[model samples]
Target: MRKANSYLDLVLNPFNLFRTKRILNINPTVIPQRKEPESINLYVYDYDAENIHEERLKNVKDCFTYKHSNRVTWINIDGLRRTDVEVICNHYGIHPLVQEDILSIGQRPKVDEIEGVMFCLLNMLYFNEKESAVEVEQISIVLGEQFVLSFQEDASRDVFNPLRDKIQFRQNKIRQSGTDYLFYTLIDLIVDSYFVVMERLSDKIETLEEDIVRNPNKRTLARINQLRKEMIVLKRNIAPVRDMVNGILRSESNLLEERTGKYFKDIYDHIVQANDLAENYRDMMMNLHDLYLSNVNLKMNEVMKVMAIVTCLLAPATVIGGLFGMNFDVIPYAHHRWGFYIACSLMVLIPLVMLYIFRRRGWF
Candidate 1:
């Protein structure tokens, strides 16, 4: 069997190439740069039934002042500089491993409960239209008794603006609820943004399907491979998040109230739905790949068929020409004037007879 040409295989089967080569020794602790550089900004806000106070802390020391507040405090520290995250973690009593995970932006999505604090890690995903690729940022949230600390890798964009609006406008129960509810709202916001990404992918898939049908070329194959890679990344990021939500639902931690389980469950359901959509898109992409290969093969077969028919029709002329051009002193057509006309007639008539036979046999 021929090997299938697929980007999915190249991504999923990394070791396949190393089967005949020696493995390299490399350090696993090194952090790779995955995003553009941005300045660190800290935004702290506390809200209650009657009032909301927002503060922009200049130094890490000032954020510690709100640690013991009675209201629901949300401290969002954007930009994950190593020293800055270490300082914030020290002040907030975050676990060392959790801090490391936060600093290591490539960490997978997970939930960890240590020393009465709930640490949840998730990916914030968006489609970059200019680059035609998916952009991923890591978001780490720590839920305590009275405060929720969120660390974001990128400071440029956030998916929690609508939730922030709801809190500022006093439009919902977010202010009345505890920090657990606020945590749930943040997660819900991230999961909801997955649908936006899905919509964009769906649009691209539709356009690609049309293009594959109308004209399959190198450009179309490149697009199919690109979409396949994006879907693979989306699936890899989302699957662990779903597991993290499930972990949250199964936990009996006091930081996450029993009442909040339903909201997390809702987020879990949405994640499942998103995974289903990704699976469908993956299957469709595989089918598109096969469709592209089939189109190419069919086109090639058509060209070969036409060439074969032309060769069959010319075989008789080639044979006749070779026979009359022999270097004999007395060839049959070399002496008679009528012999050349007869030989030309025979060549034309022979090819015409072969053409008729081929047509009648449905070879054309």
Candidate 2:
């Protein structure tokens, strides 16, 4: 019931999407930086409206230096280490529970306030073009009064570089705003990536729908089923995130500045759009399933039609042969010279007449 009212407030305004979705077209990609195998990477951007400093820190303890910095700081950890996350959370006054959520991978999307920090744990979705599937990377963010700490499951790639560029090259509102706005920007980018993924999946569904129309075989059926399952995963991830956004909106956490409310609301609207699109796609999958079944039925009907016509054409031959082969039969004209020829001719001619009639009727 609460969820329903929250959704009522969350209108999927496309105009707002155009203004808010800053990175939808650019595509989220890795910047191709090399890292040691299985080692944690810590990158920090300490910035304010006037000045900014970016660095790659060698130690987790280096992040503590920005804990109380006057400027808004964003500490992005590409890979997760339990001890490192714990130490940072302890110094930053984040609750143990929130730290656990950050360290754990594949946590359900949620929002909560603990020890004056706004924490969000959700999946950062990306489209894998090569495999033609959605790939999820768990992202957990802890937004404090002056800093935002983000933990990503995979170190290879992420959707944050575009936001980084906005901070670095461009003098955007994100740089001028506080940690809460930074938090909203991060959430907004993740939501925008959802649209990217949905667009790709939509293309696949379109192509598969056409294939189902022209020629749907066992392999095609399998592909449809696989996409349907992917839809389930999407709904599961998206629905909760919508609720999570609502939780953020309703929170009275001081860490989330009141001015940032509008930005977070924009995220809510985009998420609703993604969730609704997911449902539309699910319905499309069902239609595709029904289409595949219908085409298979049509093919079966064609085979049955041909078999019925062939049986009709052979009936005269079977009856003609049966009459002559009867044991006690005194068949009329059985010994006649022309009798055998007439019977054979009738057998051949009757089928031809039936086939001609069928052709005129357009049965095939």
Q: What is the TM-score of each candidate against the true structure?
A: 0.84, 0.86
Candidate 2 stretches with Cα past 4 Å from truth are: 1-37, 359-362
Candidate 1: tens digits of C-alpha lDDT, residues 1-364: 2245444665565433332121122232777554534567899989898889998886767888788788899999887777788898888888998888787746779999998899999999999885456778889999999999999987889998998789886657897789999999999999999889988998999999999887888778877877777887678778888899999999989887788888998999999999999899899999999999998888889899989888887888888889889998988767898988888898899989988888899887
lDDT of 2 by residue, 1-364 (tens): 9777545534443122332232132222423232324688899999988889999997889888887789999999887777777888888888988876776644679998877788899998887785455677779988888888998878888988889889975379887788888888899999898888889899999999999999988778767866776676678778899999999999988777788898888889999999999999999999999999999999999999999999999999999998987886588878899999999999999999999999999998
lDDT scores in order: 0.84, 0.83
Number of clashing pairs per prediction, in order: 0, 0
Clashes of 2: 0
User: How does candidate 1 score on lDDT?
Assistant: 0.84
Using lDDT as the measure, the top candidate is: 1
- In terms of lDDT, the poorest run of 10 residues in model 2 is 19-28
In angstroms, how far off is 312's CA in candidate 1?
0.7
RMSD of each: 6.6, 11.8
TM-score, prediction 2: 0.86
